[model samples]
Target: MTRRRPPVTPDQIIAHRRAHVISQAAKVGVSAACRAAGVSRTAYYRWVKAAARYGSAALVPKRRRPPVMPTAMSAQEVSAILAVAVAHPTLGARQLLRHLAKHDVHRSASGVQKVLVRHQLGRRAQRLAALASLTAADTGQLTDAAMAGPFGFCQAASVAGQNVSMDTFYVGKLKGVGTIWQFTAVDVATRWAIVALIVGDKTAAGAARFLDHVRAEFGRLGVPVTGVLTDNGPEFVGRDFTSHLGDLGIAHHRIPPRSPNHNAVCERFQGTLLHEFYRPFFYRARIDRIADLQTGLAAAITDYNHHRPNNGAYMAGRTPRQLLNEKRPAQSAA
Candidate 1:
């Protein structure tokens, strides 16, 4: 059974407060004053405390419970750890943990690994790690651009809510739907992924719409978006696209041309989605295929977010949603 909530309005609250104040001035007992105001003694006292601290606006209903993140570290601490990961993209989880400890940020290697898994930093780490051990002799004949990727190693998102990596993947051309575009966004700190499928051309309008979808999704999840990482695709750099992002106060960071590694998280997910999602439908009959594709994509995404087992060393049996829920940061204390 669902319990009905009472409507709280300014007028109603003002009247309640007035009654409680009048009853108190009349030398009424605390319980009696609360009862006259249709509230409890505890609530009345809390309001009194609020009034003493924050003035009349304190009468507005306050959130009863604060947010919680599983770890003991603060947002700043998490950010610092991520900053290191972003800076040294080649570092393994154990190496990262040792690096952090060197700077007085003492966290177990498992903790650092969890952060890496949640951000899908494994691929970039592996790529850069291989390159890091290469000798000058090994690269002497190679061009600079051929050796180091464009934009080099980018920083990881410091805060769970701070940055999201966005990229567009081209699905095969459907008979009726023409070209299919999957615009994917993954939170740089959490592995939470969202994919928006489009049947039409991937235009500025489409990119803007996708950005709006990302904003709404993150908003519902209580994440504060700071920046979007994209490649120099026309869909992302067009006037409508950047303009919409600007309106929402979201910063746009475009990776260097020819450098998909800069947005490695989103890029890797595209491959995963292709294998885990689109491949199964490749041989299906074309009759009413778009609907089937839509349903299949939706189901695949649902499982990916909630049910899919992550095999990363740090993630083990957990899913993206589970990791995100566990590591979701709390609102800072007042």
Candidate 2:
């Protein structure tokens, strides 16, 4: 086998050539020194050229220059753009550009969007709203469940004491009338409901009849109700309706005007009843039959309260009857 060449070191090569140039000053030139050191004459000439152009430091390797800086924007300008993005997450780049232009930012929409995407500032508007809503509450009080959603209420007692939710729906066309009114009263705690099919009139007498029906149903269920909650409809807000509830020693709580979420439970249940029972039957019969409608309503309510599963955190996948049993075990245990 041929002899292996020794590993070359930069310092060794440089020093060896430098010493050869000094010691063999008369016998060797730069080309001869390179040949003896096992380096190419061309490489030696290149080094000499570089040294002449950039001094002895050219023989040492230069550090890499940092990458070019991207188009620079001031921190305040960036923050302003970010704030706009936070406010309107779903806004398109064009819209954002327009908004920025209105505020005198004077940047192209695509350019601003490029900045937003690079900074990961793009998102949907609702997500921002949800994030904003998550700030800590005042003091150390926990969030009230009733304030949360349809099933969010303060306590189990709030349901048992007197809190009620009421709503009205149409029972299709009645004889000589376009539609009949079906008023409902639901106990927030138990999910127990009392519904009445009344004539088209929304008079004090009709309100009284609904109250009487609710009282009878409450007695049958053996649950004492403390409050009656209804919308601000003229019939519900009248003096006659207030006096009737007062006479029964029950409090009346009117939901805030135009806030359907306040009476969400009753409203949701009414929709369910209309879909599952009333609509199908009315469509088939072509006319409302009071007796048949009443039977259907009773059956639907029974299915809803005892058999249907409540999809609320308070009920925790339990049926309304199971929840009622848990709340007032004495009656439910029987």
Candidate 3:
């Protein structure tokens, strides 16, 4: 059997009863009406005065007033919490509290969380976005003419070739060529990208070939590709790909299932290639040959890595090529 909820009389009914009591008082007397209505004389008088001043609508009961808590966070504390949260977007409230304390801003983890929630930054994603927005503003990327991207605060690579993210893009079928796949590899630190086009099917062998291309490209930069991160796709996880990485002495890192953001650096570069290069190039020029497309892709990659100013985190208004070149002397191009 379902349990019954406590009956709550509607506000209209209460207002009507109060109105009737006032009317009854007009007919008989105030004290008699109060006794009949089972209400105190003081309450009856107060309601009468309220109805007269604010109309009969005022006869309805009001909810209990909220009390102000003295222990609530101060404005400065809230500011500190928010600032710390945006600085370390990936950190939780407890982790952020320590940072806040470093700035001499003391607050409990729960208090910091409350501030975060109030500002609609309770989630780590929201915090990341806040950091991105802040970075965009700092880098002058956010303007009336152009707005910065969502991943503007992308994680910076500490060292070149330490971590390389790889992914496959299915570049639709051509009339002459059956199907084409574009394999992409991006250095996490410098955002240096390498694209290889494969006609027909994408296999583990193709992926391995792409790895070799990445090695050759980064090899020119004088940095050995140490680790390769990719999604848990068949081509990437297959024995052939694994064996190739082993042969080259490169570590293979696969992101967890259903988490595309883990390999987001590769994903972002692929998106940039699609929107900035392929889409625009295809719109103006017709390309039926894979070699022609590869030629265009190579030029686009060169422009992207060398010319285009990256506003992402740690870039400091510099291009990926600039960072890579700087790393050449130190031998840590990340």
- Candidate structures ordered by TM-score, highest first: 3, 1, 2
* Pairs clashing within candidate 1: 86-156
Q: Candidate 1, 74: how far from true, in Å?
A: 40
**Cα lDDT for residue 83, model 1?**
70
After TM-score superposition, the amount by which residue 238's alpha carbon in candidate 1 deviates from its true location, in angstroms, is 0.9
Model 3 C-alpha lDDT per residue in residues 60-123, reported as the tens digit of each score: 9998889989887777777878888888889999988778888788777887888888887898
* Best model per TM-score: 3
Question: For candidate 2, lDDT tens digit of each residue in 1-334?
Answer: 9999999878666645654543453368765676676777676667667767886666655559998767667677777776676566678767877677656676777777777766655444432432242321222122332233222232223334356677778665677545678888777766766788876667766887788788777766666666777789988888888888888898777776787777877887788788888878777775646777778878888888889887776567777677666555354336
What would the C-alpha RMSD of candidate 1 be, to one decimal place?
A: 22.4
**lDDT agreement with native, every candidate:** 0.71, 0.66, 0.80
In candidate 2, clashing pairs total 6
Candidates 1 and 2 compared: the better one by TM-score is 1
Provide the global lDDT of candidate 1 against the true structure. 0.71
TM-score of 3: 0.60
lDDT tens string, model 1, 139-200? 32222322243233342554455558888888878776687788899876566888888887
